[model samples]
Target chain A: MIEAIRECLGQEMDADSRVVVIGEDVGVLGGVFRATDGLQARFGKERVVDMPLAEGVIVGSGIGLAMSGLRPVIELQFLGFGHQAFHQIGQQVARLRYRSQGRHALPLVIRSPFGGGVRTPELHSDAFEAFYTHTPGLKVVAPATAYDAKGLLAAAMESDDPVLYLEPLKGYRLTKDEVPDERYTVPLGKLRVARAGTAVTLIAWSAAVNVAERAAEELSEQGISVEVLDLRSLNPLDIDGIAESVSKTGRVAILHEAPLTGGFGGELVATIQQECFYSLEAPIIRISAPDTPYPLGGVEDLYIPDVDRVVDEVAALAKASA
Target chain B: MSESRFLPNFESIAPFSRLTESGILDSGESPMSDEAVLEALRYMTLTRVFDDKATSMQRQGRFGTFSSVRGQEASVVGAASALDPAKDWIVPQYREFPALIRHGYPIENFALYFMGNPKGGTIPANVNMLPMQISLAAQIPQATGLAWGLKMQGSDGVAITFFGDGASSEGDFHESLNLAGIVKAPVIFFLQNNGWAISTPRENQTAARSFAERAIGYGVEGVIVDGNDLLAVHEVTARAVAKARAGDGPTLIESVTYRTGAHNTADDPTRYIDQQELEKWQQKDPVERIKNYLRSRGIWNETLEQEMLDSCAAQIDEAMEIARNTPLATSDALFDHVYAEPPQRMLDQKLDWANRNGGAR
Candidate 1:
């Protein structure tokens, strides 16, 4: 996934003279994760510039650059660090184009790695999609696979509206897939049914999709076929996709790496219930992190929801209804 | 021998004033032609008239809360005079009526904003002026970025952002200055030191004697000009813009001025300011000083003053009429601009509001 991000950024910068990369250590250092590696040397310092350690200025510069007919792909270092620049991203960048009544076209992509399970420092692995998803006029995309990573990054670069592109910290190098060399784009506001099933459906995105797929495999051994739904985009959430899956399977479980209370799962659960109230056989279940700050790096494996947690919860829902 | 007579040997800055308050010009070649002086003074007077009328309209509940540019006319106008609208960009804070008008923004745009219309921000493309930002110093970074973009495009254009004494205390100001310095961004940080952030005094904003002195630590040059002196403000800004376009990096300009009115319609300055201080600023009013200067040059008289006042009154009335004739916005107007394509949740909210409002939305 990390390679996919770097290669696509290279391709996009090569393709468009307007595409410029800006962030902390993005120039010579190529970012902490090397997501923008080797572009500065090829594109020159002005196009792939290293910014001062100021998140507000980074995002704020993105807005001005976008306004001046440039497509800026800004890296925020980490999702949790984005809170420091929330006013720029949330207030101005998200609302400027809309408030200008379509006069300002802000083609800015704010890319940040999110989620836990990798032993990283505090504030480096928080899943903060809910905050961006809740903002109007901003699109949020979370990719769970390398194929989607390259495709979504390309799509975000090509998008007219500002996109909050959230990459997974755990899946950056751990998760691998055969991404095409040629540029391709996956449309936003759509979901993919990774695997089809009959009894129950498990919904997740980003790194949590791994847990859902694994849990479905475990449940299949017991003859309880579980459908897996990957919500590729959070803002224009594919409501019809979730509704169709939930109606087919009578039960569901929502999973995410963010905290339990006020997490995105709550909105998904409510949405599914509203769409398929009569199809529900038992109370829906949610597998997520505890409502607490991200724990120490050593306890990350235990902190984030795992396959065991997903399998246990779905099995309990199945037994409860039967 | 015990107490040697010592005169102040430090180079004291005689505040750069080309036009004296008593209708006299100090010995030097004038920076402006007679027509330019008249044009500047007219712009200042028209801005003052607009502000006064806006205040009255707000008092009568015809407009939303309004901030008056009562005493900071020369600071805005003179800085605006330094820029060519074709090359330089103006990123302004909220109280920039004269600058916006000088940059080709219609006066009715401000009236539209005061009347609570979002269309007020939609300035024409050729003007090269950004919309007025209400968040203290947030536009500073954007200005730097725009300047950087211009430099990247190999254009000899500069971007200038306006803020006040209070905004100098914000983190945005410091961060923007730092970035502008590091990248050698072709930008100018124009600080209108109006002595108050609502009620906070300039002395309380910083302990560093003057705001311009901080430029040393930020790796940028800075200048201090008499904000009420139009010639001084225009000259200093022109120099700064020249250096920025020449690739000498950013500049911090501290324009010392005063705010003579209440912060906004919602607050009264009498509760927080000393009456004697208000009297002192009123004496140095930028418009009166320029009018005196023009009068000293044999270009201003009773007939011109009368004609100018009458023309300004009619222009303001026309602008207000435009704002007044604009129909009130409905709840659907809120949903219309939220996104290019309304998300499902936004659509649902709009539908729900329409249902509750008897299809009014």
Candidate 2:
């Protein structure tokens, strides 16, 4: 996964001189997870610049650079750290295009690692994709695999809108794919069916996608057909794909590591209920962590939804329907 | 913490002046030519006239609350005139109408902005200026990033951002200064220490002796100048612009000036400022001092003043007339410009709003 990101960045920077990478420790240290490893030596210090430990400046400056007709890919280290920069991200970066009546294009790409299960310290893991999804002018996208990561990065660069690209920390090293070396772009705002089935559909994104896939495999062993859909893009969500999947199955479960109260899962459930309400055979279940701050490493396992939790809930729905 | 161990007395970049308070030419070694001085005098007078007109218009219930750039004309005109507008950019933090005007942003747009129109904030494509930033200190970091891009693009362009004394306390200010120092970004941190950030006085804004002194901690050059002294402001700004273009790194310029009016039209200065202090600043009026200097040079008189004021007043009157004639903003304008392409949800909301507004859905 790290190699995939580095290759995409290299290709994009090689292809266009306008593309530059600026973030904390991205240049000399090759980023926290080495996602940008070797980019500095490959792209030079000027193109791959390391910034001070200031998140607002990182995002705000990215806005400035983008306004100056340069593409700045600002890395926020982690999603939780993005709080320090939420003002810039939510205010100037997102609102400039609209407020200026389309006179300026803040083509700033903000990429941050999110989701829990990595035993990270305080405020290191977060899944606040909804905060960005609710924003009007910005584009929000989350990729669950290396293939998607590379493609989306390429697509984000080619486009002119500001994209808040969320990368899962667990996927950085754990998730891998036979990603093609050459550059390719997977169009944004689309969902992928990771595992197809006919009985029930499990909708998930980021790390939740893997958990849903594992749950689907486990449920299949017990003769329960479960379809797993990867909701890669959260902002411009593919509501149609979700409606079709739920109509085929009649039951659905929305999953995310974020809290249950107002996560992206809630929006997906609402959309599904609205479009596929007649096809529903049972109430749509939303599985998520309790509405509480992410616990320390000692109790993280209890907070994150696992394969068993998903299977237990899915199996019960199937049993209730039968 | 030893004051003199690491450094000597913080050399005051003494404010340069060629004219006295009453307008006598105290120093003859002026940087500007005779014609340039006349031009500067004209701009300062026009800015003051526009400021008074805006305040009066607001009080007459024709527009919203407006920030008047009264005594800071020299700082505004000087900093703007020093830059190459075609290559340089101005990140305005509001209250820079004079600078924006010098950058080719029409004064009528500013007048329209106060009249509650979004199009009033639109700077033309030829003008290198951003929209008025009401959120304090946000433009600091943005300017740093802009300079970084300019350097990367191999352009000699520099980025200058204007802010108030109240903004110096914002975290964005320190963060941006540190980043600009580290990257040696070709940016200028222009602070118009206009005595007050609304009701909060400059003395309460920071513990540092001066806003310029705060720059030293960020590892950037700190220089102070008389914001009311036009030549001093222009000389320092021109030097900083050239230094940035030469890639010597960023400089923090503290334009020591005063906001001679209420913070905004909604404000009443009597609530916070002493009448005596207000009277003291009036003596240092930017336009009158420059006019006096030009008068001592046998170049300014009542006839010259009347002609310039008449022309400027007529121009402003025409702009106000145009604004009064323009139709009110459409409700649909709210939905437009939120994104390059409006999404399905926004489109639906726009339709609903239009229908509810006038059955235009």
Candidate 3:
């Protein structure tokens, strides 16, 4: 995924000189996530700038740069630190296109590591995609593997809207797969299925995709058929894929780490119930974080929906059908 | 022509002064256009009447709690009128009724906001203004960014942002100023120093003598002006806005005004502030000073003043009726604009909620 992001940056800068990058340690240290590693040496500091340790300044400047006919890709060092610049992201960048009567384009992308399981300290492991998704005129995407990361990064850069490109820290280096080095763009709303199954559909995105696949394997051993669907995009969600999967399986389980009350899970469950109301053998279930602030330390695992939770739901569904 | 006949260069005027309290434009300044002076007074009166009526409605439970721009109308209207309306943009904090109204926002829009509708107060897409923001200092960087966008579009338009004295304490304000200066973006930071932010006094807000001085550190010119003097405020703002539109970079304007009312109907200034301060400011009310000046110029009369008051009251009454008659926002709009194409999740939630709540069926 890191290599894919770097490759996209290289391709985008090569195509458009107006595409510049700015973030902390992005130039010399190659970013704390290594997504911009070596872009500074290749694109030069003028293009791949290393800004101060101020999130507000970084995002505020991106707005200025984007307004100046330049496409600036910004990296927030961590998803938690983005709280510092929520005003710029939520109030300014998100509304610039609509507020200006489509005369202005905030052609900017904010990329950062999000979600838990890396054992980072307080504020470092946050699932903030839901927050960005809640905002208008902003696109939020979380790629679980290399292909979506690279394709989505290219897609985000070429677009004229602001995008929150969330890189799941747990899936960043641990899960690597083949990705085309050439320039290829993935449409914002398209979803890709990581693995296919027939009995019950397992819907997930970002780090949850990995857990879904693991649950699919465990459910297969228990003579339970499970289909794993990876939701590559969040904001412009691939509803077609969701409907198609639910139509075949007749059962759905939505998964996410954010608290369940206003989580994307509720929305997904609602969508399945609406689209395939007659096809259901059981009510659609959601395996999500309990409605609480994400707990830390020994309780972090409990805060996130895992493979065991996914398997348990699958078992109950399979038994009900039998 | 005597030296007094020449327009007084705002560059020489004291930032906060009371020369205009006697109800006369100094004879030294160039004779101003009679029409321009009347227009300024007209808008100022309208703003004052509108504020009073809106508050009364809130008290009567006709509208929700509202932020009143009572004493600071002259500063807001003067500065807004000074700009080229077609080319400039406005980013307003909650308490900018005078500026918003002058820029073509109807009083019904305030009703829309108070009625809990997002689309209610939404500035028309074609208008050069943004919706009023309630979050402290959140709109500063946005104005800076919008101005920068305007510069990139090759238009020499400037964007002005309004905030209260308390908002100056937010980090976004400082960050926005630094970026605007560094990029030389055409934007103006208009700070209304209205003495108190709810219960907190100006002395406790910041140690910096004047908020405008902070711009100096950002490599831009900063000025302090008596916000109550409509002519002085207009002249100072006109010059600063011209400089910005000409690509001379941003300016920080500190308008030293007094809030004659509570921050809103929700607040009670009598609790923390001295009653003496309120009485003292009544001696220098912005609208009364302008009216006194116009009467002295022989352009205004007792009969004309009474007629204008009656007309202003009638206009407010009409606006109140329109605001009250406006329909409440429907719940469907909440799901409608979240995205150009909402995800299935949104559609599902809308359907589920609708089916259960009876909106879907």
Candidate 4:
């Protein structure tokens, strides 16, 4: 997925002089995660900027470049590290267009690896999509597959508003699929129905999307039909898609790796209740990590909402619906 | 009119002034043209009128709270007038009522923003001013970067950022200066030393006896001026801006003045400092001094004075009417512009809210 993103950026930069990538350890060092490897050598140091150790500066500079007709894709090493730059992201980049009444549009893509699975340590694997979700002027996108990543990233880079592109850590290296090196943009407000079923619907995104997929496959073996929906975009949710799936399934198990309280699941549950109320045979269920600061990666196995937990929730929903 | 002096150094780091308190031109000075004087007076008057209108509207619950620039107009207008509006950029702190106006922010913008409308100062791209930075001195680095960008693009433009004396204590102030020096960005760091940072006086803010001297540490030219005297400010700023546009690095100008009113209407200055100092600073009021000078020159007559006051008051009244009639911000608006396409969570929240409330009421 990271390679696909790198290819997308390289292709995009090749066509436009206005596009630039900036972040800590993005130059010569490539990136700590090597997400931006080989690009520095391809595009000189000026365009592939190696920013100072100030995330706020990185976000702020991205805003400036975007405003002056430049498409700046910023790399925040980890989602947890974004707290330092939240002001620029939340206040300046996100709010610039709305606050300016469309006079200024910050076309910036902030890419950061998120979620927990592999043992990376504290502050390195937090699933903080909700923090940006709460902010008014940011589009949050979490892609599970390489195809969605390249397509959505291409879209995010070109969008008129600021985008918070969360690259889940578990999927960065582990998830690989054939991603075509072409200029294509997947619309930001669409959801991908990864698997189809009728009895129950499992909705998730990022690494949790994979968990939901595995859970659906396992549930199918148990003679229970399950639908797994990958929410490509977190902000402009595909209401029609969610409504159609939930109405067909008659039950739901919303899953995410983010902490349970006030996470994206709470919104999904309410959305399903409102839109597919008459079709629902059972209450909507949410399977998520416990409501606590995401634990260290060493203990994160206990924190991430895994395949078995998702399967169990879907099974419970299927039984209840029956 | 000899090309204004560049990086002039005096033995002391105190206030620099070419004009006296009486408005008498010192030696080596020729009287300004009638048109230039009127232009200066017009920009300053507009600033004063704008500030008065904004503060009054905020008090009346029209706009959000504002940082008042009542006594600091000279520093704002003086430096703003020094720049070529087409080729220079102005990065303002919140209290730049006059500077924004000078840089072509429509009078209606004040009403739009101060009247609690989201449209308040929705800055246009063609306009060289940035939306006022509410955080103290945060715009300094941005101005530096902007100047660097302009330099790289080979545009003959200089960027000037305005902040209060207290802002000089912030680390961002130092970092921006260092970067500008290293890159040789054509920028100016203008500080309005209003003697207090929301009740914390200059004495408590920094130990560097003079904020202007801080420029020396960063390898940029620094000058201190009597912020009350508009002429001294204009002359010094004109010189600094010229050097900057000429590819010389940035300059720092500290305008030593006092904030006569509370920091905001919420503040009570009477509780903190000496009433005597306030009264003394009031005697050196920039507007009063300029008006006195104009009256003495016979350029401002009783009729013109009365007409100007009436016109300013009438304008404020009309602005108030517009603000009063403006509708409040809506809820879907919260979901509207965060991004070009809001994520699923945001869409869901808005839809759920619409379902509960029967549409964003």
lDDT of 1 by residue, B1-361 (tens): 7865764223534556676766477798777777877888888889878888988888898888988888999989889888888888888898888888888888877788778887765677677777788877888888988898888888899998999999989888988899889989999999999999998999899977778878878899878888998887888888899999999899999998999998899988898999998899899998888888888778889999989988988999998898788776666767766666656878998988877776854
After superposing candidate 1, which stretches have Cα over 4 Å from the reference?
B1-15, B351-361
Interface RMSD of each: 1.8, 1.2, 4.2, 2.7
Q: Which order, best to worst by lDDT?
A: 1, 2, 3, 4
- Over B92-177, each residue of candidate 2 has an lDDT whose tens digit, in order, gives 98888878888888888888888999878677888888888988998889999998888888899999999988998999999999
User: What fraction of the correct interface contacts does each predicted structure contain?
Assistant: 0.48, 0.72, 0.28, 0.34
Per-residue lDDT tens digits for candidate 2, residues A1-322, read 7788888998999999889898999987899899788999988998888888999999999999998889989899999999999888888898988666677888778989998998999889878888998887898988999999999989877777889999988888889889998889988788999999998899999888999999999999999999899988876777778888999999998888999998888888788888988999998899998899999988988998999999999999876652
Deviation from native of the Cα of residue B293 in model 4, angstroms: 5.8
Number of the top DockQ candidate: 2
Which pairs, if any, clash in model 2?
A: A98-B337
lDDT of 4 at B254: 92
User: 2 or 4, which is superior by lDDT?
Assistant: 2
Candidate 1 local lDDT, residue B59: 82
lDDT per residue as tens, model 4, B80-110: 8788878788887877776777777665676
Off by over 4 Å in 3: A6-52, A57-73, A87-108, A116-122, A130-139, A154-162, A170-190, A198-203, A207-226, A236-322, B1-18, B24-32, B115-119, B295-298, B303-325, B345-361
Query: Candidate 1: which docking quality band?
Result: medium
lDDT, candidate 2, residue B69? 83
Q: What is the Å distance of residue A117 in model 2 from its true position?
A: 1.0
